[model samples]
Target: MSDIPAPELAIATRNLSKQFDRLLAVDNVDLEVADGEVYGLIGPNGAGKTTLMRMLAAIEDPTTGDIYLQGERLDPDRPNPRLKRYLGYLPDDFPLYDDLTVWDYLDYFARLYDLREPGRSRRLLEILDLVQLIPKRDSLIATLSRGMKQRLSLGRTILHEPVLLLLDEPVSGLDPIARQQFREIIQVVREAGMTVLISSHILSDLAQLCSSIGIMELGCLVESTSIQELYQRLSQQRLQISLLGDNLAKSLDRAIAELRNCPQVESWTVGDRQLTVHFNGNETDSANLLRQLIQAQVNLYQFQIETDDLEDIFLQLGHQQTS
Candidate 1:
């Protein structure tokens, strides 16, 4: 009887490393990304995030190791058109044809991807609409703004509807509005079953978009996990308690006394009319603590849990520096 094949991952790497003379740009790292996942990569300026991605995109050769895409082994040294066809990579500086109009630019890439005739025209129109370039379809590439160019490049990247999308600092120079639009586009693609591997300095965006994240530093993958798991394991819960009453001092005193008796309350600080507390407890514990506080007549106006975000977790990890 024949053995059943293992289920394929969207991406997998084993003992991957890249060295440039004395510098080890990417160290021995084993990374995996499941299908239909949006994985965010983040680290400091010299953290080797870009190098790692470059190797994955097959733009740069790894000194050692193996890469697998959808269970098929990839050899960057040899031409693998089949594997390449399923990958869409948008590097930091994507080259565009300045002489071509928006429609012509996408048309050129469509032909390169072996898209032909009526279907090619239809796909180009759909891509232009997706990237919000329908109105600018006739505009010269050189006449477009930076944000428009970014979106256009993204449209080009997804022209062939690749299963794996790799974007490196795609939102680096965009303003808030552009970033939001780009983020929305990414969500649309992700919903369409594309596995995206994105790297950026914008932690907040990643916190919102990625199902999982990988942190790299000093030519190594220091950490990788689902966003929820990362938060549940590393994040500390804090409660902001605001007191309301004419006699604020008395309410504050009572609140402090109540907090002292609560074991879930690790520590707390008093402000003008609020208390910031470090709490290490579950939802039940929080409820009990609230009940106790209310019974003590602490005049509580607000009791809100403030969980640490991705930036906070990243800073707390202390793995920002490459060295």
Candidate 2:
């Protein structure tokens, strides 16, 4: 088999901190993202996810700490022109020229980026297709929907072929179909080897898209782990059984007794016609629990494992941080 190339480190932050007056907007944080990796920063309102992004993009200076791009220190005080050449940032609120047509708007940015005549046309067409805005190229920007406007903004951001894409709430207001389209575009960019740092409150999207995620609360990063690591660490091995009966409490007690007597079962709980059994082993132990329930003649209407989802983990961490 051919060897897979190692993904280069595209962005890194060390002890990154930012404050607003006496309030700490972003606490000391560290991050490392590989080239072509989709890294997500997730949190509730006022969690400082956007502040961290701004600092990384060099749009804002951190009160303390350092940021590096491609192994070179990012000098915030003295902005580097070359740094901007391969970095694209899409803020939560996208601004557009109301009078400019979709094509004209992109062309203007291409000129600003110093693309020559031939290169300018080539780049514009490429980004338009990538963003799926080719059909609306001649349409006025004012006539576009929220999703279309977002696509146009993304096209403008990547007009210069930036290697790093920093997007904040890219699909905040998009409809379900639009959101799906936006995700597809991001995946396409990832496949093309562009590193993406997307911040959003939508845990479902992050779970589906991000290989790694950082959960922040009150200006501090609480959890940073790969998707698989998170699943393994937070996996719930409890089985939930719901039985049909008028004497629900009696059925639940009987189920718990049967589960507790099993050698593989560690513990059990009875809750209003429901019996939750915590197995001593992993999923393999669940089969034993089901067999025992059937042999005991427990009228089981529904029997399933209770798995902790990304949202559940996020909420648990957020509550811990707040407490």
Candidate 3:
């Protein structure tokens, strides 16, 4: 459905694939993640998410096809030493040096990235402040809460100033408040001009933070859509018309009888004074229905239209593919 041309892709894959012996892990997959864009990858378990992530991180080799990082082709066999400087991979279970203080922990990573002199200290301080761990710089990693540890791990990932972040279920175990805090950190990273490929089953969070999304099923990318376009394309609604006056039961019967044959209505529920129509049509159809009811002398008070939620659209897409 996307007709837009992609002239600038931060991470692009051409016919990417992977296989474990006779088992096909990832099918021919093509993706283009834009610069500074938060692209959410979602699918059920065993959807080849981890396989794809490993390939992206150069931990696993693709059987065929090319992976371009920042528009430069990456050869897994002879991975460019500079590639590590431009990429960061944070798995679901991010480990932290439990014995090291927050400052020392981050300092360790900074040194590993060869962040030297006063610039290293400046960058470490900036990441601490960004992750809201400035006050905990002296606190030991073992003493920090789960959410705090998550933040610290994230800070380590960006300690080297990587251009792209590959995060798998980054907020899986956080509480609501913690999740929001993590979201803020990602927003900050985006503002600082970093592209991210995040995989998670937490659809609501993805819906909120991601600019575009890729839906994978059976190792195939079934759909790729922008959040804006997805909302517009899948926004279906229901209309409930409430009637006025007495003899409410009679009114419902009349309305139901008249609407029983209308294709504009998919299904409906009738109450004493209300007719809840499961409408799969547009505003014009709604207006026509209202006019028809008015002309038939079925007095009504309220006509409410309600759009379906994101979960509905997500489930429907999966169902359609399987069906």
TM-score of each: 0.92, 0.90, 0.86
lDDT of 3 by residue, 223-305 (tens): 78787788788867788889998877666767777687578898988775777788877888888887777777787899889
Count clashing residue pairs in model 3. Answer: 0
**Candidate 1, residues 1-323: lDDT per residue as tens digits?**
01221345798888889999999988987888889999999988888988888888888989998888887878877889989888999999879888999999999899999999889999999999999999999999999988999999999999999999999999998999999999999999999999999999999999999999999878889898999999989988899999998999888888899899998899998887889999998999999989998999989889999999999998888643423
lDDT, candidate 2, 89-191, per-residue tens: 9999868898999999998899899999887898899988988888999999999999989988988988887899999999997898888888999998888
Over 4 Å off in model 1, which ranges? Answer: 1-6, 244-246, 319-323
Give the Cα error of residue 294 in candidate 2, in Å.
0.9
The best candidate by TM-score is 1
> Looking at candidate 3, what is the lDDT of residue 23?
79
The global C-alpha lDDT for each of the candidates, from Candidate 1 onward, is: 0.90, 0.84, 0.86
In the predicted model 1, the residue pairs found to clash are none
Order of candidate numbers by lDDT, starting with the best: 1, 3, 2
> Candidate 2 vs candidate 3: which has greater lDDT?
3
After TM-score superposition, the amount by which residue 218's alpha carbon in candidate 2 deviates from its true location, in angstroms, is 2.3
